[model samples]
Target: MHVQKHFGKQGILLVNLGTPDEPTPRAVNRYLGEFLTDPRVIDNLPGPAQQLLVRGIIAPIRSGIVNPFKPGGSTKLYQELWTENGSPLKYYGEILTEAVAKEMGDDFIVRLAMRYQNPSIADALKELMDAEVSSITIFPLFPQYASATTGSVHQEVMRLLSKEQIIPNVNMVNSYYEHPDLIRVFADNARDLGPMDQWDHIIFSYHGLPQRQLKKGDRSGCHCYADGTNACCSSISRVNQFCYSAQCHATTRAIVAELGLSEGSYTTSFQSRLGFDDWAKPYTIDVLEDLAKNKGAKKLLCFSPAFVADCLETTIEIGLEYQEEFEEWGGEHIQLVPSLNGDPRWIAAVVEMLREEVGSNVVL
Candidate 1:
């Protein structure tokens, strides 16, 4: 390990969930190796053993299966939406980082990394080390918490630094779904939707985790998986603590209050599920189909609160695929509010992350 102490600068390292190096099978395989094999990501498995299993078993199939972004020809209408910016997730992630750096002024260095692929945690830390930055704070860009997502990324980051023998006085933002400013951003999204009366349903769709994985939270009994039947989530002790479902429900409540909208005006569901494993139930496709069945949902609005920027899951899965599904089922229109990308108040939230984690005096 490369042990180092307090130095000239502090760094705010914003680590977003990664994308494949390119939208190809080879790239996806490489990305999934670093991603799915993490013990924190696929908890309960033995670490070294899981790594081997990932290499020997999972990567080959996952490569073909999990390419969130499909390659489309130039003639495809989807190609029309493509821009010089490429993937909106990476595009907005960089924009948000650079914008935060400008706002943070001097004395603080801001950098970003994907938890899985290019510009990785190792690279980000090495940059900080070269810049003589001694302290570091990691803001995993997940507003809500998940072991496979936020916690796993956090663990991998620590693992790389530990191997390098360079552990900075690191602080982490575990979850901020309840952050007042974040709530305001969601409120702004509702207003951006225009006449709310015209919309029959607002769905808060978060990324899903397998039920087994959700139950396997390291926090264990500290959370509420709540069988979703009885006081399961609330009435129980910490049993439901690590449950993403519970947190998504809480986010729905917070958003409702923020928008001054009443209950039943909205419902929360999970999206972007992979494989045949029973992920969190009431699949998004099913929900949209039901809305189509109801036939009165003239307008539909969906929000991906788990993600801060528009990514494949949000843009392609939710926006494109789900919109098509809604149309197929007969819903008139679906409007997806973009994430808090470069928004001024949202910018302040990023700054708040820096100030609270790295050090002080980070203002443009």
Candidate 2:
């Protein structure tokens, strides 16, 4: 390791879950091939099984190269999510990075990297390293903590830095599920939708992870997969602090508190579960169905707190497909609260968090 004693300028790396370079099937295929292959993403599966699933099933179906098992057209969804600029995820990420770079001026070098795909963590780190930044802080854009997302970014950062002869003072943010300003931005987005009473029910849906992943991550073996009991899995304790399910619950609680929503008015669920394996309980689809059918809910508001920017999961999945699902269940509307993509408050929160982690003197 290159051990440099005196510090130069602080380097800030803004990392987000990646997007395909283009919205085509080929692009989507390469993206999934890289993303799903990461051990952090498919942690529980055996290496051979993981490769088999990715190469034989997921990638081929996504790219439309294999026809026997035709999965839904990901390219169409990507087309819907694509804007004048490009993928919403990457577009907003670039805008956010530019905003932060301008805010910090030249003293701090702010670079954006996708955990997978173009502008990857490795290339971005190499850029920072070339700049000879004496210290570095990694800010994974995920609000809630999960090994698959934030943990993966940190793992890649360390793995690359480990090969270097000289290493700078490195720091990484684990999670900011309940950061005050972040909560404010999300809540404010809800508030912008007029009165809370307008909607019959509200749902905070976070990206899902397999329950097995939760169990694997649980250092306190007893704390995870407690049959969805609020006592054990709801509260963030010393034992289950890093649990993705628990933090999702915590984020819901915080945003609801900010909105002054009553206990029964809103609930939390997990989304984007794949395969037959059980994932974080109370799936978003189930919650939406129940709301539309049994609960007599007409209009519903959905918030995806896990994503900082509106992406495929947020825009096409929840906003479009979930809306269709809700309508099929006789629901009037299901409005998705927009993500905190380029919101100034969200940017301010990022700066604040960086300042807190680095020091008070960070030029923001």
Candidate of highest TM-score: 2
Model 2: lDDT of residue 256: 88
Model 1: worst 10 consecutive residues (lDDT sum): 71-80
Clashes of each: 13, 4
- lDDT string for model 2 (85-112, tens) is 8888888898899988888877789999
Number of the predicted model whose lDDT against the real structure is largest: 2
Candidate 1 lDDT, tens digit per residue, 1-364?
A: 3334454777788888887655555666787788778766676578888888787668756555343354322113224334577656677788889989998888779998888887788888889878877677778888878887788777877777787655656667677766777888877877986876667888888888787776665365434334453234322236554466666767777877878777677777788777777787667777888877774686888888888887766777887878888887778777887788667878888787666555442334
Residue pairs that clash (backbone atoms under 3 angstroms), model 2: 1-165, 2-165, 2-166, 2-167
Alpha-carbon lDDT of model 1:
0.73
Q: Write down the lDDT of every candidate, Cα atoms only.
A: 0.73, 0.86
Q: Report how far residue 342 has shifted in candidate 1, in Å.
A: 2.6
